[model samples]
Target: MDLVNHLEGRLLFAVPKKGRLNATALNLLEGADIQFRRENRLDIALVKNLPIALVFLPAADIPTFVGEGQCDLGITGFDQVAEHDARRRAIARDQAESGKSTPVEGAPAKGCEQVLDLDFGACKLQVQVPVKGKYRTPADLIGKNIGTSFVSLAAEYFAKLEAEADAANGEAPGAKPLRTKIIELSGSVEAACALGVADGIVDLVESGETMKAAGLEAIDTVISTKAILIKSKNPSNKTLVDLIASRIQGVISAQQYVLCQYNVERKNLDAVCKVTPGRRAATINALEEEGWVAVSSMVEKKRIATVMDELSKLGAEDILVVGILNTPKPDELSEELLNANTMSSPQPSPPTQRRSSSPPQQQEKESSLSRLVIAPLTFISFLLSLFLVDTYTTSSRRRDRGPRSRGSWLSALLWRQKPGSPY
Candidate 1:
């Protein structure tokens, strides 16, 4: 079993425990071949192969866990990281004013920073109203209560809206005090207004299906968000953190495409190659036919059919699209790995910046737990396939004795397998 030793200071990666975030995160991790097997009711999963521990938790809590250094790294939504930053800034200021250190360990020794945009769990935090609300622009929400889970972000957006509204009235922007009240809600933020709790809402819009079903429409977007990899304001485990991040980038690249190769006439090569400009195509001489060349290139699956049709139109014959299980070049994975690790040394902490945010581990021995399980199960399956092949080949074959008393090849082989008796 491939496993990692339970060292006291091993890296902990916090990810969403459930919901859309959980599935996407798992898929991304698996694509990287990080090797993990999940079990029911387990919050922590130790990677069988790497010195890493994964802690599953609510998506909203990832920032908190990593911010306080309970985790060395976290995968969370950009919105949550922004929210945490706003809150942390506020708390850090309070800590500085009192001449006491923040209780939150790992609270970016500097300040909050967003590391990687994971490109999953995409959604928009938007301001929405009933489908036909007369309030069309930012000015319409003046003095209205806006329901939102992201009070900090919503407040910031509305404040900007108030300035714009003021400017439209021939007043200087930022000259008027914003009258919009941001009502924070834990859930069902959209229903709040339809249920008469607020005039508008700022909440995540995924596919716009739910909002449309609820008889609401997005009017203005506060921010679009996706999962992001975050680290301590000043991370301690820069090398390990970078390694995981690069693996993530590699996995993403791997899922994207395959290389294709085929032979075509030289006269039609230009037309065919034009259809795949973004691809790094190569040409080689064809031995089978005069004035023919073999072409190989990378093409996205989604674009292959269209490009193939275009190639056909251009007179390229004998076209073939081969599936690629892997590609070694342009090494996106290798680049990510190198970049993540060889960056700068730790910098000194930035000056304390404070505002307002009010909110709320253990060096366990490096558990020799494998980050992955069931790998042996795969090897077993391979062995079984091998044995089946051998058995099938042996059973299906027959030995022949020509120009002599007929004897099957199998009979001869079996005779060889027998003890001292000769046939």
Candidate 2:
């Protein structure tokens, strides 16, 4: 079936089917209350209660599909995003060179846009040296064999290092920069050096355990890697995309927090409020016991024990910590999403301007009067436009071939008989 025809009006969300980030990714959706089930062999699934089809794909391939417009949204790693971004930048430069169209100064080079970091699958892409080797830094690996799965990113990293190294030594402007041989390996990059396949290795390290087991130590960190959500460079349904992304953020918050409910004397209200200040202020309710109140709030799951101890010390009673299934809509963001132009730093908001001294009541009255009058005016304008269009259409139809009965005209267009075939 044709893609557009089969999934019309549904947003495509590309997801990693299996990998280090897979479990976390699936848990995120489930926490967001997006129910879905994929067949044993099928890679696509429809999310219940939303016009979204989840496409299971290799994490590495997600960026390509999203960038190419084959998928509308994606969730993948920061390393993948950076790699694809480099490719996009190259493509934009090429397009500019061809004089086809000038790429925007800070627009995403590829068609994929970085929506925001979903805050899971955290790791580091690093250059590691054998524990007993002489190589100590990226500088030592110049012109040496470096093995890894992330060939493009490692190459880009080394290219910059080589450039800086030559520039520092005052090499000629056009001199050939010292480069490293990037030996690509699908897995077991830690074993590359021992096997003599390469002198050093560049790969992702979550805890440095694997590299340590193989007697390797990371010397240089190229970049930190984490799971992130991405959207089309130009989204057709921006509102829907943001809503979905926001829900994912909410799920992250829900997992990290727990609802804490407790009872406390009214005399200790001020102190209790200071202890468990939910997202804003703790909810307080009147209890049957005189001078007593019920306090409910959200507290970080990791800090629950300490928080509970603090509350207990304050003479609080019946404290309970309830795990949250999901937050649904988060008031606080776990991480900021990077936009299309690759903004690494946030822009400061402009200072507020002073408003006029006029009373708010006066302003509200004027706004209400304007709205009341604007409605009828708008309705009249709409009616006038319709009348003019109908009149023009009727006049044109009569002038072209004279007017016919309305039923006859409709039947002739819908059920017209052709000479070549039976009706």
Candidate 3:
């Protein structure tokens, strides 16, 4: 309750407690310089130098918290947010038509705004069937049992198909439709067909090798997804939120690019610039060795090898590719925006003050007479409005759900990929 009441003017940033996306979330924060420390099972960590709190939770819970305004920002999969948004829109429509807010227990909260894609956890929700099965397309499973972890998304996808098919057949849209039976599963969706639990399955595919091993073949992609940063519809601290988001963006950009530095003869400067132009322009310096120029620029990490080969062939020597850490190229930023961000940038605290800190004295000072009278009075009406639902929610997770944390999951390394076959 005390924590709930103290949220004013602070940005609540949620990250995955454990999952494939968990490590990425932590890495982003660390790169953004949001210093935080968690002690002995504490779920929330207050950032040392920023007005932010890091809430560790299941990735699935992030979108809901942001939508309900419990969190200002979060990092989660795009697929999770998509299903949640669809559920919210459907419920809001129902409430509007009935003139009553339908109290939907276990329904996801709405208004989660996707701010950016961090681009790491890339995969697709796909419809897969046994290789030798009679199913030819999504419509062929009209009367067959389909299994998936993403029941909401799969059900919605087939429902839209049902409507489209009915209209194509000249049947009235209002007529009761024959739907594909969707069986929700916690994990192992790939084996659903082989084990007779389903004739087909819908699940996320990073590489598609898992489906192939399970003797399943993909017929269609339901949705493509990746890691994304999201926020509430309207944040209480938009500036802080944007600032952190941009800083994280800078880190992501740094990951995708590396600084290429090389010395080339001044005569070949044009060729080098054409090969590795930084975000804006390359920095060129006159080398002490006459007629030589030192050229430095950002190059896409993925193309570094080809870029190096090209530069060497073009007579450039001492070619070096340096990895950037936190700083991103600021060529694209406007002057005014940079000025505004500079004003709010966190300043470093004195090392002496930190090393000589007195915890007891600090606590006593905060709990002095003035604070004792004012703090309680200020939050006298704060309440933790936790609503428990009796509604039972089914899992849409694929059957091989590994240990939820990224550290543990990596040992098993959920390797999803495709090889050999075309599709």
Candidate 4:
């Protein structure tokens, strides 16, 4: 069977073949229930349940494949995406200047769009120099050699700095333009400074431990990055792409939140609702015993302890925090499942709504009557206060009888004075 023909109808999902992101990306796919099996030494794995083929590629290369429309979706670092985008723009600029095709052959003009942040593989791309070296700041390393695997990103960073420096100098005579040389290295970028190959290096810093071991200290951070999902601007099968994105999002949400259930008295339900308001609304069901209700909500795992304490303070009992293995978004649930849930579970009334003894029409009438009575009384009170202030001001004026004794504005409005009478 021809490889291209076999993969023709399937969505191409690119992922990290090795390194820090590989295992985590695989785990995410598993969490999303995307089962797959790859043959030994094979780079591609066909999904057992979906029309998707997972293409294992280098993290750096995944962005390029996705951006060029060779792959429909991919998982890679935001730093890699930035680097690839920078290179793509530079190439497009060169092609434009040369009056050639704006887009290179086999590469689309449109690039990949970030769909979701995976939140793993968090790190910073930073400019680092030797601890005892003369270079302390990024400015000190200007016009010097900087080694990095991200050549485009390093170049772009220096270009911006050089432009800013030039603008600051403002056409000063004999002022040379700052030009930092970027040395592209495939690996071992941290050792570039000690090896005498570069004055400084631009690399990813996770814990700063490796940089410390390398006798390096970061001076400037270029970009903070984490693993993110990206898809082509114009995907061949948008439905399949969206479905995959939804599944991944469900997995991410499951990891973030846990189900918290508790029983609370009806009187305290409102106060407890404020604590665990949940993603949209909390689920409340009437208990067997009167004046008690069972409440369930999704609480963030990081703040679960604080939430439970808050519930306890609000007189909630029988609190339980349950881990969620998987949680699909409400909209993503099938009609059958939604209908079943609707039938099995009682509809939850909003916590904020309270039972009123008076009917809505009676309540409206009472509100209107109160407003009518209060409006006139409030106006009368205001007038009385103004009269009292005016009287006090007049008495003070009569006692002082000075040229600067100007009557209060309210007194002037309340009384008209004769031309020659200081009354």
Which regions of candidate 1 deviate over 4 angstroms? 1-7, 88-108, 111-115, 132-134, 168-178, 267-271, 277-290, 323-423
Q: How close is candidate 4 to the true structure, as a TM-score?
A: 0.76
Backbone clashes for every candidate come to 18, 1, 12, 0
| lDDT, residue 34, model 3 | 89
Model 4 agreement with the true structure over 153-226: per-residue lDDT tens digits: 99889978877776787944432433899999999899999999999999999999999999999999999999
Candidates 2 and 3: which is better by lDDT? 2
- lDDT per residue for candidate 3 within 4-28, as digits (tens), equals 5555667899998887898878888
Largest lDDT belongs to which candidate? 4
lDDT of 3 at 231: 94
Query: What are the lDDT scores of the predictions, listed in order?
Result: 0.68, 0.77, 0.76, 0.84
TM-score, every prediction: 0.67, 0.71, 0.71, 0.76
lDDT of 2: 0.77
Off by over 4 Å in 4: 1-5, 101-109, 172-178, 330-423
TM for candidate 3 is: 0.71
